[model samples]
Target: MSVQLVANVLIGIALVVFLGYRQATWRYLDPTRIWRTPLIMAIVGVVVLAQTTTTITTTDVVFLGIEALITVGVGLTMGSITRFRTVATPDSKGRTIQSRTGLLGAALWIVLIAVRVGLDVVGGHLGAHLLTSTGTILLVLALNRAARAVVIDQRIPRDDREARGMMVR
Candidate 1:
């Protein structure tokens, strides 16, 4: 292993740790319908990336597909475990309070990153580029976000107008 790669990775890990913890500090963020498309796009884009990559093999894609499913399952479980509080009162901005009881999101973020890093490291040793590829990382993140969004959406209540429509504000 190159010393430079080790140093760079160490720095990256440190940054991720900091950011993961920081995410927990958020009291709450409004769940607007605006985020739906982007989150869905994130999930689709990774699959497209996988199909377009000529260097990756069929076996790699299958493995990644399995990993994606597993990640989604775990993410869903964790997201459900995460506590959300919808305050009865809307803010001055007229936004509902979508809050978490603990650092579950932060915890999920760390696990996602750690899993990606672990796979990358092992794949490097085995010459499995797919396992360590950018598409894999994006897929993990996309699935994680999707699961959380699904759970949070179920937790927050929307008005009749919003519910009647496809969007939730």
Candidate 2:
């Protein structure tokens, strides 16, 4: 078997494990606080992108950069939507609007990929993908933390009131 095949298999296994872990944790453990969904998706995207690598070119780098920018804009929009929904209509129906945090997370992953491609295009002066991935991972971690802080600080009281059957009016 080729090294690429081996890497692909490993990545697949890792994704499976991550999914299992997420499902189990959400179902039986702590559903409210588990924030691994974004990180997991990011890892899966990176793995898929890495596995499909042909000869890298400037065009590829530019395309990746454009895609990354678009994804980030989408993610920011999603985050705003989530914040709006969570704030403006808290208890209308929990199942109505989809959460946008996942989109933001996916965008972060794309940003990492774009950074990697950029580094490669710049003659690989750095560790390319590894560094880019690490930086984006850190950014994601910070974003998640900030988001949780905002939710905890702002949303909890509203949620509690709604749970107590108190109408906001």
Candidate 3:
């Protein structure tokens, strides 16, 4: 395998491990802060896309579209299964809502990774190489996280949303 591809695989695995842990642990669900990760991932993905020399083809487009759909679907599923409850913040007497994916959420992440890998195998055979690029992977991850954030935000009470400095949709 090429060095770049190897590096991408390592980075992708690291991200999965880190993000999976974060999602599986109970953390304060601040609507305002939850979107940051997705936004940052998207920006980085765009930057990587700009720097890459890969030629995009129709096959790449089709595969990426399908992958994006699957990513978002899995993310939404994770959000729906997430456990949320009010809890006292470590440093504060007041209670704020916290969320965790626990086991099921983590399992969904594994499913997403499996799906992405399966798609990569098919796309590679079909010469849809962009599916294997770092940019594409990051973009797919951002879409998944964004979809999950949307579902989580929706579950938050309007009062809690506004109190946490998030505009209610």
How many clashes would you count in candidate 3?
A: 0
Candidate 3 to truth, TM: 0.91
**Worst lDDT window (10 residues) for model 3?**
158-167
Per-residue lDDT tens digits for candidate 2, residues 68-140, read: 4554554444334333223344334442222333444444444544553454455335223332233333343
Per TM-score, the best of the predicted structures is 3
Ranking by lDDT: 3, 1, 2
Better of 2 and 3 by lDDT: 3
Better of 1 and 3 by TM-score: 3
Best-fitting candidate, measured by lDDT? 3
lDDT on C-alpha atoms for all candidate structures? 0.58, 0.40, 0.83
Model 1 Cα lDDT, one tens digit per residue, 1-169: 7564565467557745764664466344555542463366576657656575548666666657766777787667755765544566766766555555257657766676677677666665666666654445555656765666666566554442232222344
Off by over 4 Å in 3: 89-95, 158-167
Higher-ranked by lDDT: 1 or 2? 1
lDDT of 3 by residue, 31-71 (tens): 76778888999999999988889899999999999999999
Question: Where is model 1 poorest over a 10-residue stretch in terms of lDDT?
Answer: 160-169
Stretches > 4 Å off in candidate 2: 1-35, 83-169
